[model samples]
Target chain A: MTLQILLNLVIGMVWMLLHDEWNMLTFTIGYLIGMIFIFALRRFFPGRFYGIKIWSIIKLLLLFNIELVKSSLVVIGQITRPKLNIQPGIFKLETKLKSDWEIIMLTNMLALTPGSAVLEIAPKEGIMYIHAMDVAEFKQSIVRTKDLFEEAIIEVMR
Target chain B: MNVSAIIEIIVAVMVLAGTVLSLLSSLGFIRLPDIYTRSHAATKSVTLGILFILLGTFIYFWFMHGLISIRLLLGILFVFLTAPVAGHLVIRSAYRSGVKLSDTSVKDELRDDLKKMKQLEQYHSKEG
Candidate 1:
């Protein structure tokens, strides 16, 4: 991914030099041209083009922000309710993520979203212990969120 | 009325919303049942609140002063990266040190897994 970005930047610079226009617009056009060129010859590269990974990352961030807002609202509601009716608990999450980076990403995302916090990760067993504000309410959604994040992480990583 | 005025209005709204969200998060911290849930409030809403506030500042500087502040952008990024991790670590340590969940808590699923893990560790040590 870094290589692709470096090469694209070099291509953009070269295009600007050729056009004798060192402006933002010229450089952006050059970058787009280089992106397309890179996409076409992506098979020669060791991995996926950086643009796809970048897009996946943006999608992941967008998903996280949306989830954050939704969950924050729910938490606010929970806090302001006349009577607290929460059933908090610790639950085991069996994660499909194998690598340290992906596991860490999932852990962090889980911690912030939808009334959950990570307690511990048993990497050997591929299990994470999550503490949920309302275990019954969040169980199904937690699995769905995990799958959503796992897919997004795989897109960026694999 | 003008573009700069409109931008200032937006910045004001953003900052206000951010402040409200942060206030709600602190409310959550105070009212939540346990350390785990409290950390949730501390991490998620607070991060979003700070993000909104920083973004508002960034936009304000860009439009009002014609200056794009890298510090504001980096501050937003840093909060996004660190808040959840900090919350997670705090909760993890609290749990590891055997903090009890609230009475309202429905279940403790990790206890069985932890017991099995401890037994495995003991078995390994005995063999060694």
Candidate 2:
């Protein structure tokens, strides 16, 4: 990814120098031209263009932030209530993610969202032990959230 | 209030909210039943709190001083990346060392699986 970005930057610079224009507009036009060229010769590249991956990454981050806000509110509500009546427990979840990077990302995202924290992983078993603050209430929601997150993570990692 | 004042107020509000959330996370440490739940409080609430605080600071600098601070942006990103991992590590070690769950815990679905895995490991070792 970094290599692709550097190549694009170099192309943009070369285009600007050729036109003798040292301006943002010149650089942008050069960048777009380089992007098209890269797209045309994409089969020669080892991986997808850096731009597409970056967009997916941004989408994942956005989904993460949205979950963060939503779960934070839920936690705050639980905290401020007059009674502490949460039933926390550890539950087993089967993870569809195969790669270490994807699993790491999913676990971190899960931990940051309220109610669920990854307690342990059985890598060979493809399972995770997740502790949820209110297990009964959160079981279904957690599964839903995990599916959403898994889909987003796969979109980004693939 | 003028536009600049309004922006300042927004920044102040965000910072205040973040501070409150951080305090709530600390309160969770006191009120929560055990290590697992406390870790959840620490990871989620505190992370969101710091994110909010840093983001407000970023916006304040960008809008009020017209200076884009890369440090604040990186701080936000690093906090997001590291906080949960740290929390996870702490809780995992605690569990491995045989910390007992609180009485209020409704179930432990992982326990049987973990035991079965241990038995399998022992059996494999015996065969080898």
Give the best candidate by TM-score: 1
Residues B1-128, candidate 2: write the lDDT tens digits: 79899999999999999999999989888988899988988989898999889999999999989999999989988998999899999998998788999999998987788788789999999999
Model 1 error, position B32 (Å): 1.6
**For model 2, how does the per-residue alpha-carbon lDDT over A55-134 read when each residue is reduced to its tens digit?**
88899889899999988888888888889999999999998999999999999999977589999998777899999999
Candidate 2 segments whose C-alpha is farther than 4 A from its true place: A1-6, A19-29, A36-50, B122-128
- The C-alpha TM-scores of every prediction are 0.93, 0.90
Best by DockQ: 2
**Candidate 1: segments with Cα more than 4 A from true spot:** A1-3, A23-25, A43-46, B125-128
DockQ for the candidate 1 complex? Answer: 0.78
- Per-residue CA lDDT of candidate 1, range A1-158, in tens? 78999999999999999999989999999999999999999999988778878899999999998988887887888888978899999888898899999999998888778888888899988988888889999888988898999999988778
Worst 10 residues of 2 chain B by lDDT: B109-118
**Residue-wise lDDT of candidate 1 within B20-74, one digit each (tens)?**
9999889888898888788888988888899889999999999999998999999
Go through the candidates in order and give each one's DockQ.
Answer: 0.78, 0.79
